[model samples]
Target: MAAIDEQIEQVERRFGVQLPEDYRLFLRSRTGMSQFVPPADDYLMLDSADELIDINEAGEFQERFPGSLVIGGDGARELLTYDFRQSPPPLVLLDTAASDWSAAIPQAPSLTVFLDQFPETGWIWGGDSR
Candidate 1:
């Protein structure tokens, strides 16, 4: 738990943005979750804080969407990210393959709401799953 907090702190420092409070709480509670397997073949799952930070720091994502933190993804192309630039922050789905930032879709208003919307099966392809 302490280690997770440390990792979260490190991410904030490196990214220059504070994570959503609910997300910070979530990380402190769980190490990681299973791969998201939504019905549409698209999926989303939480990543370890370390991997979360690493993905945000990666060249591909950085070159395309700066100031975005990759939290999870569809396991193949799309990415679920927290757009720090937005007030209150927003969870967005990025189309990685196309490298088209405009194609990004807003998923939730905040991390807490996003988690609540996750399916019982642990998948999140986007729907009224909550």
Candidate 2:
């Protein structure tokens, strides 16, 4: 489902941070997806705008991830996130149970790249790139 500007703005207001332009564009077109089976064989479920707020707030993500936003996750222990600690806020894969930020693994430089190359390669794991 595509999200309107107001809905997107609501998400930003909830987090007190502007989402990356590329990600905003994604939400405009494909706000979320469910049970998207990629080549990695892991089921990917993207969160809708409302779900984003619910997930983040319910999980206390602000305290856990600091400058990052949880966009989606594998049904299990992994999460696809936008690490906002840097300019452009590169997307990353993180273990939900991670004890420190250093465990974040680089997944894509941007959401556009992630979608463009998603079928080719799903979430990347097992790296210490942060």
TM-score of each: 0.81, 0.85
Which tens-of-lDDT digit does each residue in 65-120 have in candidate 1? 87788888767677778887787888887777647567677778887877666553
Best by lDDT: 2
lDDT of 2 by residue, 1-130 (tens): 3347888889888777899887777777775887866565567878877677777775566788898789988777788888878887888887878866788888888878777777766667667342
- For each of the candidates, the C-alpha root-mean-square deviation to the true structure, in angstroms, is 3.6, 2.7
Weakest 10 consecutive residues of candidate 2 by summed lDDT: 121-130
List per-prediction Cα lDDT, in the order shown. 0.74, 0.77
User: Residue 39 deviation, candidate 1, in Å?
Assistant: 8.3
Task: Give the backbone clash total of model 1.
Answer: 0
